[model samples]
Target: MGLTAEKRSADWLAQGGLRPTRQRLALAGLLVGDGEDRHVTAEGLFAAASDAGEKVSLATVYNTLRAFCEAGLMSEVVVDGSKSYFDTRMDDHPHFFWEDSATLTDAPKDELKITGLPMAPDGTEIAKVDVVIRLRRK
Candidate 1:
């Protein structure tokens, strides 16, 4: 038999080393209940919560998302100085940002290659590199 929504949420949270608080469970239900990968912004998630009759604040959404990222539950994609998206898939991959539609979609990671990356600062070590290819309609 398939896992119930509550059980699935709890298990997912536990896998990420997070306690499944009521708020977290509610948000997680909305984020991953369908079992499909997605990219969402804080504002978008808050709106979704409201649409789903979840009484969660925007600040809470942001905080929860950050916590989830820290717990390795999701990955953050920074499109620019002002825009960020949280990706449900945690594996290293590239994304395409559609400028006109303000949407993000995955790029085939196996098809991408990075070369000639500059060295990090003297005391700093390089972490994972994220690639976001921005596109616009012709």
Candidate 2:
């Protein structure tokens, strides 16, 4: 990664109240260093880290992802009960899941319209709505 990207990653972690540890910096560089959003699974990130010569275990990747989500740096989009994708974009938006390829991408917000939603049960209010549109080729 370029020096500027590395500096941006460090700043981002600090803004999220996360320390810029070596592993965190490495992973952050991969995620947002390019100034482009990304959707990545834990396995995918682990592979990328391995290819980048970072000595991080799959469990560490998972834990780091969880921490990122907790810190509001990333959002977890669960496509199914078995798998989830971490999104670098924190905005409230829907996503499109390619079933065949097991990949996720942002759906067009302008094309989506949520007219109504059912009332939540007592003692709880709606936090956020996550829409995942699954797609598959014929």
Q: Which residue runs does candidate 2 get wrong by more than 4 Å? A: 1-3
Scored by lDDT, model 1 comes in at: 0.91
Inter-residue clash pairs, candidate 2: none
lDDT of 2 by residue, 1-138 (tens): 345889879977887999999999999999988888999999999999999999999999999999999998999998777798999999889999998899999999889999999999999999999999999999
Taking the tens digit of each residue's C-alpha lDDT, what string does model 1 give over 3-107? 777887788899899989989999998878767789999999999999989999999999999999999999999988789899999899999999988999999
The prediction achieving the highest TM-score against the true structure is 2
Can you give the lDDT of residue 36 in candidate 1?
74
Q: Lowest lDDT 10-mer window, candidate 2?
A: 1-10
Give me the overall lDDT of model 2.
Answer: 0.92
lDDT of 1 at 54: 91
Q: After superposition, how far is residue 134 of candidate 2 from its true place, in Å?
A: 0.6
